[model samples]
Target: MISFGKILFFPILFLLSLIYRILFFLDRSFKKKRTLPSSVTISVGNFSVGGTGKTPFTLHLSKLLHSNFPSIPILILSRGYGSSGTGTRRVSENSSASEVGDEPLLLKRNLPFAEVYVGSNRYNSYLQFRSESRIPNDQKVFTLLDDGFQHHALNRDLDLVLLDCTKLSKAEFVLPLGLLRESYSSISRANFLIASKFSEEWEDLLSKWVRKYKPSQTLKFKFSPEKLIPLSPGASEVSLKDLSGRSIFGFAGLGNPDSFYSSLKDQNPSQLKTKSYPDHYSYTKEDLTHISEKSSDQDYIICTEKDGVKITSLIEMDQNFSKWFYLRLETVLENESELVNSVRSFL
Candidate 1:
């Protein structure tokens, strides 16, 4: 049945698209777009507004770059979404989510060896990082621009767009009414298209969609969920086998909580209750107390790596409550050789 919410969604989508177009026009016309030299920048972004596994993909790409080019230092550029900082801030080991946002903090934690900086303005961030004495001026550098599909100002050597295969199966529309940030046609801007979190059944459907939408792009990849890790520091990392038959109270503040919930069910295959908050929701001590009360009966609390980082920080307040764990996923490209070759050819 058509609900009132559904009835209003069409106009809302129209309005969202209108705003998007206006912004696009302003960006092209009024905004003084900045383009850095093409020698060192690569962008990993998504067309959709929510979680398309961009963080994991960005990490994966960073690892790939590090492995492929060991001599060159890799730098990550992020918008620092939900961060309190106004200008460019270099993410350090001690940086909190509130200071530099969750993803940037996560990146810094995961790849402590690399440099991670957050800034709304890509050009300024680049300049700041470049000016650092440690980062040699003459050495060739590679910068990974996170969530930069629409950040057209910064020139990039590679533009990798992530597509959530599950979302593609459903009805597609632009934001306010839908999850998509931009039109499907925007896929053309991508040098590489990564179809993420798809099952075998969805592969045929995704192939068709890619052919229709981005036929020129040949490099394609898959994102695979690898394993689960406990959120608390020094907690034992467990495989999916370890979680089997466990009662899990899954909680997350993610753009795609269902993905985390479903993945948990698959790994555990037992009684699993979930609580979802908005994407980038900062959980307080009170919030944890409430969740703890609700999940008292469950064997363990589980969350995504994104949520794990945030929630783990709050563990100091309630040391007794420590059931939360996170999933560790890796980007598994279908044609790794081709992807590497294409990127290398471009570089």
Candidate 2:
């Protein structure tokens, strides 16, 4: 039974949402007329707020494209949600999570060859790139837009939408009430649908859902993390085997903390202790102190690559907390040929 508060609150929310939808429709129509850069833009985003595995998928796609066209210049554009910068800036090896956001920093660390840019306005960033001489036109330039499914202002050549299998069951209500960013009908905008974190059971259910709800023409791809790479301070390389038999304290501030925790639990020593925080959470000294106090006996504190980037500056400030490390995860596409073909067809 619905409570009186919920019954009353829902009606107000419904009315506000109706107003929002009308405004969104008008914004989308007006924004559609803006011209995009000449470079091919491929957006990898999700329908829900979080836990759709967008980062790993973006990394996977970047690696695939880089391998196929070695000389081509690929640029990644992101809004840098938790980053410090007010305007657009190019992400480099020296750029920290505070400077360029966690995801962009993670991308730069993983794919050193690709140029990463962070800005509130992605279209403006693309335009800036087009004017820059550093990024040559002779090199086949492809723009990989991060978290841009709803960013309709910039025209994307290919729109890849990620769906979290777990969230599908709980997608009855719209934002705040439920996780969906838009209505189910928004699937019409995507050129391809990626059922991320797919397992045998989830795959079957996802296929059934797609058959019933999505267009048959929308291509589907399944993806999961291939392996985990360790993220150590001032270290270029560290293997999972190197840290075996050591007691670990795992922590991260990401959309889906469970995935990272699970990955570490599977890979780390059986005696690993785990801790989690809210997405894009900025860590304070007290938080770190609490972690240290809890895991004082532990040998090392492990975290996700994104979280590691944010904590690097903190670690650098104090010498006593330099033992922390991060593990990087990469997406392994289930259907390589189909995924490549879909992208190539768009090109």
Using TM-score as the measure, which candidate wins? 1
lDDT of 1 by residue, 301-332 (tens): 87788877777777873376556677887667
Q: In lDDT terms, which candidate is top?
A: 1
Locate the minimum summed-lDDT window of 10 residues in model 2. Answer: 223-232
TM of each candidate vs. truth: 0.91, 0.86
- Regions of candidate 2 where Cα sits further than 4 Å from its true position: 1-8, 134-140, 215-248, 267-272, 317-323
In the range 84-116, model 2's lDDT, one tens digit per residue, is: 888989888788777788888888988888888
Error of 1 at 150 (Å): 0.4
